[model samples]
Target: MYNLRRFILKHHFVILFILLEVISILLLARSQNFHRNRLVSGTNVVVGNIHEMGSDVGGYFHLRQANKQLAEENALLRKQISVVTDTATNTYTLLDHDTIYEYIPARVVNNSTGMANNYIVINKGKVDGIKRDMGVISSEGIVGVVTDVSLHYASVMSLLHSKSFVGVRFKNSQQLASLRWNTGNYRFGMVEDIPTHVELHKGDTVLTSSYSFIFPEDMMVGTVEDPSVSSTDALNKAEIRFATNFATLRHVYVIHNLHKPELDSLKANFLDK
Candidate 1:
């Protein structure tokens, strides 16, 4: 108690001066309309800044949730669009007929585009009706083919894989070609078996062919980047800029064809012969 009293006595003047200054400022602010308004305005400014900062911090934390929600919405829209497009193109098919293809939305858990045989793993598998050889696609375009499936996960052979080949055709000229990764580039793939007679252009769209049972017909694969005649007189080769950026892939849809079993069975019997 004695030490406390001595400390207070030593700084008494400074403490009194601070108290008096605070009281004077309060009195002045209350007595003068301009000062009162300025004080309120300054307080409001500080509070508003604090509120904005808090909101920004909260929003930053919610970004991943927002993105996942957006991806789910997009997956639904894509399924609807694919169904509508297919219906419009079908001539003999009934309007009320069951859809030939179904899309199962999934998140990519792991991905690699740099390897010679790049593969992707998604957070859906046998339990989600994902099967081996099912086609995978992103919102932009074709992604890959499912090769293995567990109850809760699936592995995909990405288009960037050296062994990957997709049947594709030019949208403008309808010239059929095969797309294959050469392990030389990530953004581009090689379109092979393009007929020499077909007029080649730099920007022609390459799309999935109807012959592919794995992918829906007319799905985008890529756009031609460069075209050149191959050493063989029969064929030409072109570089294609991939429609889907595998490096940025986050969500994908697995395509299940209802008629795939029948087709596979027929192929198997034919192959046995």
Candidate 2:
């Protein structure tokens, strides 16, 4: 109590001056409508900034949880979409395994798009029921196919690979085309074997064909781009802008085909013979 009194006495003039300044400012603000409004708005701005900063900090901490939640939701939503659209095919037949499959959400741990044989590494593996030849896709479109698997990781053959070829259907006539990556540019691919009568418009979207053994039928692949400079052959072909950007791939889904083993066995026994 004695120390407090001494401190107060020593700084009494400074304390009085500060209090008077504050009181005068308050009085002036109260006297002027414009000043009062300015003071309130200034306080509101400061408070709003503080709240925004707090919200940003909180959101940064919850990003991982939010991503996991989004991955789960993505898988569920894609599956639902497939189920809803699988039966609306025109001439293409949806395979039996197409209806008997599940989606395993994964994260791209590593990716390379600058090579002739680009590959992507995902965080799901055999333990998570991820096997070889499973189709991988992103929110935007088809990504790749699982080529190798381990206990906790798997390698995917990216669509940008030189040898990668996917069967795609055009939106104009539902006619099938072969999607192959030969352009060194990762953003574009070549669509071949399109029927000459089926006119392809620029920016027309292409989708996974019903004959796709790896990916689900009717999934988006990309939009048709400009005429292909590299395609010099006589076949009807065009360039397409790939929907999934390989350079920015982060999250993906691995498709689980329940009848793959049976199909493989049948192929081995009958087709091979």
Candidate 3:
């Protein structure tokens, strides 16, 4: 206590000077209109910057929620376009105007592309109306099909799988073919069952065929890669670059066919018919 008193007595002048300087600044700011305005403006700027920083941090944390909302909106828009169109007239003929496919937005929880039979796992399952045989796709293109389902998760057979078979048609010619991955490449696939005389053009896009009940018609699947630049062609078969990038697969949508039950039941008895 005695040392503290001695120290204060020794440095009281400095402390006093600091206090007086603060008081002088405050007085000058309060009395002078210019100084006061400057001070208020400075304070407002500081406050605004702090608020902006806080808002940026908050937005960063809510990105997932925002993405989910966007996915939902995209799904709704897709449903609105589920119509039968006349290619000759460029017009849609609404016979019943009934939506056939219902889209459920989901996120990829797990994915594999470096294997012969790759698969993808999504963050939704039976609880989210996901079921086996349901088609999966992304905004870019067709992804895969659901194979297994749990309460909160589901597994998908991606196009990279050796057994993957998807009915696809050339966007321009509407020539039907079956898409498969046999070259063990995730970026490219093979379209089989196409006639040997049929020539595939470079950059020609292939979309889901109406023949498949699993996927809606006209869903993008892949594009025919330039054969001259590709060395992975099988038996001179043209290589197709997949629309969906499996390595960076993330958000996806599960396709639920509204008339799947009736369509599938009838399809099941096709041999009998």
List the global CA lDDT of all models. Answer: 0.79, 0.77, 0.75
Q: Residues 1-273, candidate 3, lDDT per residue (tens digit)?
A: 999999989999998999999998987556333122323322233443454455456556657865875687679777665532224245544444477888998877567799887767676767789878999998778998887766666778888877788888988877887888987888899877666556678999989999998889999898998544333434345678998878766668999998999987887899577
**Using Cα atoms with residue i matched to residue i, what is each candidate's TM-score against the true structure?**
0.67, 0.65, 0.64
Top-scoring candidate (TM-score):
1
Mark the regions of model 1 whose C-alpha exceeds 4 Å error after superposition. Answer: 1-97, 229-233
Worst 10 residues of 3 by lDDT: 34-43
What lDDT would candidate 1 get against the real structure? 0.79
Query: Who is ahead in lDDT, 2 or 3?
Result: 2
Clashing pairs counted in every model = 0, 0, 0
Per-residue CA lDDT of model 2 for 60-92, tens digit only, reads: 665785587578767988998797687766766
Model 2, which residues run further than 4 Å from truth?
A: 1-99, 227-232
Candidate 2 similarity to native, TM-score:
0.65
Q: Output candidate 2 Cα RMSD.
A: 21.4
* Global Cα lDDT for candidate 3: 0.75
lDDT of 2 at 81: 75
Give the backbone clash total of model 3. 0
